[model samples]
Target: MEQLFFILLALLTLSAALMVVTTRNLLHAAFWLILVFFGIAGFFILLHAEFLAVVQVLIYIGAISTLIIFAIMLTRRIMDPQQPRFNSQWGLVGGLAALLFVVLAAVTTRVAWPTTSATLPAEPIKQLGADFVGVYAVPFEVASVLLVVAMIGAIIIARERG
Candidate 1:
């Protein structure tokens, strides 16, 4: 069952990523990116990282995706057809990317991961909260501050001149 889920999640992630890269419309690409993020969050859940899954959904899907879509909608000339469809160097980039992917896959297959006897624990959310508040408190606070600043910047950018 877990293997089946992993396969499905992998397919979902890959398909969404392909959609994001191949879609001509910027708005459709953003939506596909959201699906990619959602599939990644599902993978995190499968790995017993509930906190990561929730944070991925909350931060990427909730905040970032909303901001991207809102920005797209706020554009005055959204349907302009003058935008170039593809970069001239796309073929070269795609070839290099394929080569790099092959090399990485070979290296990944060669790696032997460390084995652990510890069983998966319950109440992952509680454990994650404790760790975040205790050990990761500083970084968490910094991220919150950064997000606030970004929000303020976005508001300033969108403000109308009076």
Candidate 2:
């Protein structure tokens, strides 16, 4: 059952990712990307990383996807169906992307991944919460501040355009 679920989730993620790249409409692509993010969160849940799954949903699917959609919405020209979807350098970029994919695939296939039989922590969420507040507090706070600043900048830019 778990394996079947994993396969279905993988398929969904892959299809959504393909749609994100192939869709000409910016809004449609953003929606597909959100689906891809959801699929990642589902994978995290399958791995028993509940906190990671929640964070994935909240950060990627919620915040980042919303930001992307808003940007797409604010840019009226980008949503124009008559606009040229591909640029002159698209072929070059596509070739480079294919080469990168090939290189990554070769490297990943050659690497012998280690299998760990160790059990997970009994109270991983508690430990993670403690670490966030105790050790990683500063970095975590900094990231939050950075995100806030980015959001503010985006809003200001959008307002200026309007």
Candidate 3:
């Protein structure tokens, strides 16, 4: 049952990710990206990392995805269907990406990775909270400020459009 669920979730994630890249409409692509983020949060839940899953949904789905949708809404030209999706150098970039994927696949298959199950710390959530407030407070606050600035900018642009 768990294996089946994992396979299904993996397929859903892969399909959503493909849609995110292939879809021409920026809004549709953003929605697909949200689905991909949800799939990742699902995987984190499956791995017994509830904190990480919640963080994924709150940060990626709630914050980041909302920001992306706002940006898409603000940028009118980005949704123009007449604009070419692929550039002249697409083929060269695609070839390089394919080659890199092949190399990474070969390297991953050749590795003898350990299959041992590791135990989690007794109070990981507490430690994480402490670290966030004590050590990582500056960066975390900076991120919050950045998000606020982006939202204000989006609103300003939208007001102009209106």
Candidate 4:
């Protein structure tokens, strides 16, 4: 059952990721990206990381996707259907992507990996809260500020569009 679920989730995630890159429609691509994020959250849930799963949904699907949607809405004029999706940089971009893929694959194959199962803390939620407030406080606050900035920027752009 778990294997089947994982395979299905992997397929869905890959399909959504491919759609995100291939779809010319910005809105459609954003929606597909949401699906990809959802699949990532599902993976976290499957790995028994409930805390991570909730954060993934809340941060990625709720916040980031919302931001992307807002940006899409604000930039309505640039989404011209008649515009060419692939520009003259297509060959260079494709070569760079291929090169990156090769490098990543080589690194992956060269690395010695451990196959041990993850052991979660007794109180994961509490530990997570403690970490956020104690160790990761600065980074967390920085992310919050970044989100606020992005929201403000989006609003500013949208207002200018009107």
Candidate 5:
């Protein structure tokens, strides 16, 4: 069951990611990106990283994707139909992306992952909450501040010019 979930999540993630890159419409690409982010969160859940999965959904899918969609709507003029539909360098970009994927797969397969004798804790939610509010509190606050700043910057950039 877990293996099946993993396979499905992988396929969904890859398909959505491809759609994000290949789609000509900016709005459609942003929607596909949301799917990709959600699929990644599902993958994290399958890996037993519930905290990461929640953060991925909250931060990427909830916040970032919303922001991206808003930006696309606010900057619709840039995506005017008169503009050329396809980038000329797509072939080169695709070749480089494929090469990078092959290299990463080869390296990952060659590396020996670390072994652990301790069993995974049952209450991951409690542990994650403690860690976030204790040791990681400062970074978490900083990230929130960064997100606020980014939102403000986006608003400023998207404001109509006189």
Candidate 6:
């Protein structure tokens, strides 16, 4: 059952990711990227990392995807659908990509993966919550403030020239 879900999720994620790259419409590609982000959150759920799943959905799906879509929408004139998708150097790029893939595959296969048989913490969520609120509270709040400032800056920048 788990394997089936993993396979299906992998296929969905990969397909969406491929669509993100292959789609001629930039907006459509952004939507596909959202699907890809959701698929990643699904993977975190399947791994029993509930907090990670929620964060993935919140940070990637909610924040990043929204930002990307907003950026795409803001530059409306730039995403001309009739424009040619591929550049003249596409063939050279493809050859380099293929070579990189082969090298990465060979390196990965040759590496020795270390496996751990250790058990997970019984109340990991509670521990995480305590750690966050206790030790990481200040940093977390700082990050939130920075993100809010960045978002406001983006909004101002994205506003149409009057």
TM-score to true structure, per model: 0.83, 0.85, 0.76, 0.80, 0.82, 0.80
> How far in Å is the alpha carbon of 134 misplaced in model 5?
3.5
Predicted structure with the largest TM-score when compared to the true one: 2
Tens digits of per-residue lDDT for model 3, 100-160 = 9999999999999888787877888998889888899999899899989988997787675
lDDT of prediction 6:
0.90
Which pairs of residues collide in candidate 1?
none
- How does residue 45 of candidate 3 score in lDDT? 91
Clashes of each: 0, 0, 0, 0, 0, 0
lDDT (Cα, tens digit) per residue for candidate 4, span 49-150: 987899999989898899899888888976887777788898899899989999999999999988778676699889888999999999999999998998
Q: Looking at candidate 1, what is the lDDT of residue 123?
A: 82
For candidate 2, write residues 1-162 as lDDT tens digits: 999999999999999998998789989999999999999999999999989999999989888899889888877688888887889898899999999999999999999999899999999999998998989999999989998998899778766553
Local error of candidate 3 at residue 15 (angstroms): 1.4
Each prediction's whole-model lDDT (CA): 0.88, 0.92, 0.91, 0.90, 0.88, 0.90
**What is candidate 1's lDDT per residue for 60-101, written digit by digit as tens?**
999989988888777837535577657999999999999999
The predicted structure with the larger lDDT, 2 or 5, is: 2
TM-score preference between candidates 1 and 3, better one: 1
After superposition, the stretches of candidate 1 with alpha carbons farther than 4 Å from their true spots are 76-82
All models, RMSD in angstroms: 2.2, 2.4, 3.6, 2.9, 2.6, 2.6
lDDT of 6 by residue, 1-162 (tens): 999999999999999998998799999999999999899999999888988999998989888889889888987986998887789998899789889989999999999989899888899899998988899999988989998998899779867798
Write candidate 5's Cα lDDT for 9-87 as tens digits: 8998999898998787889999999899889888887788988989998989888889889888977896776776668
Rate residue 115 of model 5 by lDDT. Answer: 79
lDDT assessment of candidate 1? 0.88
By summed lDDT, which 10 consecutive residues of candidate 1 come out lowest?
Answer: 76-85
Is candidate 4 or 5 superior in lDDT? 4
